[model samples]
Target: MLNIEKTFDQITAMGPVHLKIFTYIMQMLRDKYDVSMIDFDIEKSIFFYGIDSLKIIEIHSALEARLNCKIPTEAFFQANTFKGMIDDIVKSISNDGNLGIETSHYSLETEIQEALDYLLRDRPQRDEGYQTELTHTTLLTGASGFVGTFFLKELLENTDLKIFCLVRAADEAAGLERIRKTERKYNAHLPQGWEDRVQIVIGDMSKKRLGLTDEVYQEYAKTIDSVYHVAAVDNFYLPYNIIKKTNVVGTVEVADFALEGKIKPFYHVSSCAVSLLEQCSDPPTIIGLVNGYAQTKYVTEQIILRIAEKGLPWSSFRLGYLYTLGISDVDLDPNVSFKKLLQLVAKAYDKVEDDFFIEADAFENFLMAIPEIGCVPDLDANFDLMPVEYGAKAIIKTSLLPMSELKSCYTFYNPCPLDWSDIVNYFKQSNKRIEKVPLNTFVDKYAEYVRHTDDNSIKLLKSVVSSQLDQQLNTMFRQIDTDMVKEDIHWCPPCEKQFTHAYVDFVLND
Candidate 1:
């Protein structure tokens, strides 16, 4: 039904083992649930399709019987997508009886050390007299990526500098085509005759000389004014080596590039999710970061700090999660952009405008149910959501300002985070059929439904649970010191109701 393993020699990104299991599971889904394999999204909940509770129960039993192993019901609830289910299966089998995350075999500390060595070794004599002056040219990595494309557009609109894009392509023509596709795909409105001012360098971050010949690379070094490092592997589940090679080693390479010739100010887009000290004035560390992506980001920051110690002035933006609503359809490309990464969590929006909207499993239904069962007192935790467009503009504008002015306040997140309980009454007032059950009752229902759930029965339960925990624990909640950064262009926060409506509209229409 869904065996791509035999035909997957052509698909190198997915290894044979994964390909085999995935093909098997997808085939089972098709055969047992009447699911179509065409254009199947691995990140979407099966409930988003026509699959209901009865089919899910049948599928779960069928899979267990066929595989001759215990497949946890929680996995179906937690790993909502088919791809995630495959990963869950792999992890479960690999762990045997153990129930913890898979750890990387390689030394992550070694990966961090290599970045420091690259920046410090065979060091180019510093351009000690280099002054931060008006920009004439700028080098940017990840121009074809989601945030990169937006940042690229920002640079074009705001500055007079000629932009040099470091793109991974076979040749200049290919690079241009890639750029064209990325811009159109993201609806990046490039100004007319924008091509003249932009130059494309065909290169790979993981390779030597940025995958450029020594001669061409040197020519590039001589022409650049600044560096914007935004490209990265954002997958949380990817292996440590893949993350380290790009986020750590590739960072070292970029830092090296910035130092040679006219030493330029390096703009590194880091993440706020990096473990912060319990207090505001505490040192930044990577202790609490759970995934490889966050860990690598932490190491990359450490590398940048080391390079700065070597006399290169740099600016690091501690970016927050981008908003995942009301964007053009082109934003949801298969690549791990903000939109795609947030897909599973956004399933509530996906069902809001459906014909069965009242019958769907929804986020608010769970929240509304929380108080009745007293699982936890009404949670007032802040859950701010910043629109990507506003955040991108703020980031680009802030990056261009003098570091001293904005360095301390380089954070970009919801100026106002949402509180779950605060919004519940509003939903109730609307007289919608968002049922409220006791928390324990809801849990029992969830247990029953994962076996055979349909009718919008909390498809994003895992995400909802995580969010609830985050709120209850105030785990990562920290005040946004927006005053530390200059706001050249003010951001008007969307009203939560209006904001949600727009997102719901996009999901239904799409």
Candidate 2:
């Protein structure tokens, strides 16, 4: 057996303030709970094994009460080891003696006065050195989507670049207003006077020449230095003809416009799914088995590659699923059969069909971890998942790349390596009764169940589940080869398990 005592002694000798705090914490637990180091499995306990739900709350409460530090729940997960946990707690306590809130409760008027004083003290000071260097006017397509929203906010926050957003309709003012609302909704900390820097240009991607009249096209062509093409038909169930019209042909139109105008660079948002669905003779890579969406993305990539060969200063970013702070409100796309299965399970449980049961929230959280959510043909597959904010930051960073780097048709960016297993474990932790069925067993049982049940929902659910299992298994065997550009991407800050519990409490009470 590994010498847990020796390892812990080494950690203690490190003399990091956090390690000292942890030592104190361990002593407290030993005294109060009679929790000996021997009773805890150093490797398997909360420290090394990852934070399960209950342990996260206990740690958070302990920190607040003992050290008077208000630590975020996400911190527990990020601090995967005991040493890391101690470091974070020590930093939090040292920075502010009070855990999270002020040390003492005060009158409402006094609190308001204190808040105003703090805000004023921290206000940004204008200096010539702080002035922005970005001078060129830029154009952004697909300014409505999640990535688009984050990109717009970042540009507004960091640079003085004048932005021209492409809208589908002639009501450019209304579109711009909507963009402002979205910015405020997501980035409440945005600097004042940010909206004044943006302008909107009405143009439809589907229209030939990007729906731009000759006069407007010529004017924008002369002025705009760069174009960020973030728009695409993200739905998988949509027909090839429709997808081709928007993703491929529309892209060509934008490229043509940029080429004619002599624009320095054009940034395109492409999905990692483009590498999917190739034959065994072709180079092996994990193809997301979602459906036509992946295939269409592949075709779209070919279009860009062809354009690149002809000498267009363009760069393509292949990204995985982009999630936002807001839970997806778009009902499960029709193509996600797993969603159908969930619906079926929900219905069957209403009739008390079996002793086994799974809650809707657990199923939804599980789906979020998987690649296929808003997209169709919900295949059980792993994907590089990144928060929308991180994805946008990467796109902006890539856009700033030199013309020489823009020569390639594709440049892969992998921002987050959120393992699907971690998500599965989270769901399992949330609900202990719903045992994890092996992917094969899940498919086999689902198929058998479908044959006996005439209900359309159940049939659809089984089909989706079986297909997803097959896809997931195939992905395990097949892997794609591409040069992935890794960057230090920010993830959603870890929150305490109490936060999730709080959400659950609110939902139950409501």
For this target, which candidate reaches the highest TM-score against the unseen true structure?
Answer: 1
lDDT of 1 by residue, 341-385 (tens): 346336534533443233212334444443333343234545545
How many clashes (backbone N, Cα, C below 3 Å) per candidate? 11, 14
Clashes of 1: 11
Cα distance off (Å), candidate 2, residue 310: 3.9
lDDT of 2 by residue, 47-107 (tens): 4444434444444555554554344333443344665556555555575533322111113
- For model 1, state the Cα shift of residue 169 in Å: 2.2
Runs with alpha carbons beyond 4 Å of true place in candidate 2: 1-135, 184-191, 278-290, 325-381, 405-416, 440-488, 491-510
